[model samples]
Target: MSTATVASAPPAPRVQKRGTPLAKKRQWRAAYLFVIPFFVVFITMLIVPLFYSGYLSFFATRLVGGTSFVGFDNYVKTFTDPLFLAGVGRTGLFLLVQVPIMLGLALFFALALDSGRVRGSKVLRLLIFIPYAIPGVVATLMWGYLYGQDFGPIVQVLSALGLGSPNLLSDSNVLGSMMNIVTWEFVGYNMIIMYSALRSIPAELYEAAEIDGASQLRVAWSIKIPAIRPAILLTVIFSIIGSFQLFNEPSLLRNIAPNAISTSYTPNFYAYNLAFVSQNVNYAAAVAFILGIVIMIVSYVVQLSTQRRERLG
Candidate 1:
């Protein structure tokens, strides 16, 4: 019998001691080096601006007084100003209607694509996501042209069918029209978020569901939906934030639907006009702070509700 001996491995190197003053100094320096840039940018871009805006919010800038601290008078005016109030109401309406529809379509598409039953899902996903890839300006312009009252392809097509072309840019219809455009623009973005969440779910869960003879719909509702609730909530919060910050689409569409989209059509629009057009930077700052508070409150409520439900589950 041949005797075989295994070679013993060399001892591993000792980890370098970290608590020595020089070592700690090096570590601290490295940490500072890494974080300094971040602090610089944050202070310059965010902290300074936010504090300045907050400071301005407390004062009112008038032609007679120049700049005077009025102590929440600007805030009070923000709540009372008819145009600002109307903008807030319009934004709320958009949020209530558009967010649900956008998230629903995104969820449906995500679920359908994740299901093994769908064929050519890659192609479909690419097609769906193409709109998101298009620049917001370009997408709005393309849709605006298509919605044109005179000689646009859609209008011409309707005319050929002997049906009068519906004015999508009309005051009564513009809000709904904007909803459709926004949904088309963002559904795929939300879908990507949801699909990624769906993919993270364990295959073991699906296998167990199948073994229990659960149908596709049953598995989706009882397992898939619950597993992806966080992602859905994430999309909902994002939609809420985006809905309130509504600017690009409305701003671009204003040219096409000036009557439908007034200067103060949305809070963001109102703020922009106040700051730049009307030269009311102080009041604009107040309006912006008010909107920020609303956003923060809504986001906190959503997160709190989600956490409570998760604990219950």
Candidate 2:
């Protein structure tokens, strides 16, 4: 019987002592060097401004007594101020009316493109997304020209066709016109988001649905929509934030429709006018802080409701 001596495995390769502690320290030091600049900029640009704004919101500047600490007086005034309330209500109305239409159109476009039936869908997607690439200021100006009360193509065409040239920028029509512009700009942006989500869904799931003889509509209803609910929710939250921040369009369009677009057209515009036009910096800070709170509360409520609905489902 040969005593088989198991050869001891060649001495295990040492991990080379994961480098000396100094080397590890130097590695971490280098990593921190890369990370510090971002934190510095973030704190300087965002954190400092936010804290400063909060601080400014607490004080009140008065002609009679100069700047003085006023506690929550500005907040109280913000909640009660009719102009601020009116602007909030207008934006709320816009949120209710426009968000659904825009998201619905985006979903429709996403589904259409995903179905692979539309001719030249790639080009169509690019065309749709092109408006979003345009700067908001530029887009507003372009639309302002198109919605012009005089010499606009729409008015000219309507007159030529004897359909009666309606004033698109009239007080009653301007909000709706703005809605159209926002929808036109953002639908494709939202569509791209949803489309990307749809693309990430497993093809096997689609194949299985097809094997079950599910129609396109049925597949989308049961599979596509449910799978992309997170993306939809993200879009909803973004739309809500954007609706509250509806400043650029109204501010620029005020030039075209002075009577229709007032200084307090939206919360953001109200804050801007308070700061620059009326020279109410303290009050503007308060208004901005309040607006930020409103946005935060609304976004929180939406996320909470969505969470509850998902859990229940």
Of the candidates shown, which would achieve the greatest lDDT relative to the real structure? 2
lDDT of each: 0.89, 0.92
Best by TM-score: 2
What stretches of model 2 exceed 4 Å from their correct place? 1-31
Candidate 2, residues 27-52: lDDT per residue as tens digits?
A: 56666877999999999999999999
Off by over 4 Å in 1: 1-32
Q: What is the alpha-carbon lDDT for the whole of candidate 2?
A: 0.92
Model 2 TM-score relative to the real fold: 0.90
lDDT tens string, model 1, 226-247?
9999899999999989999999
The CA lDDT at 128 in model 1 is: 89
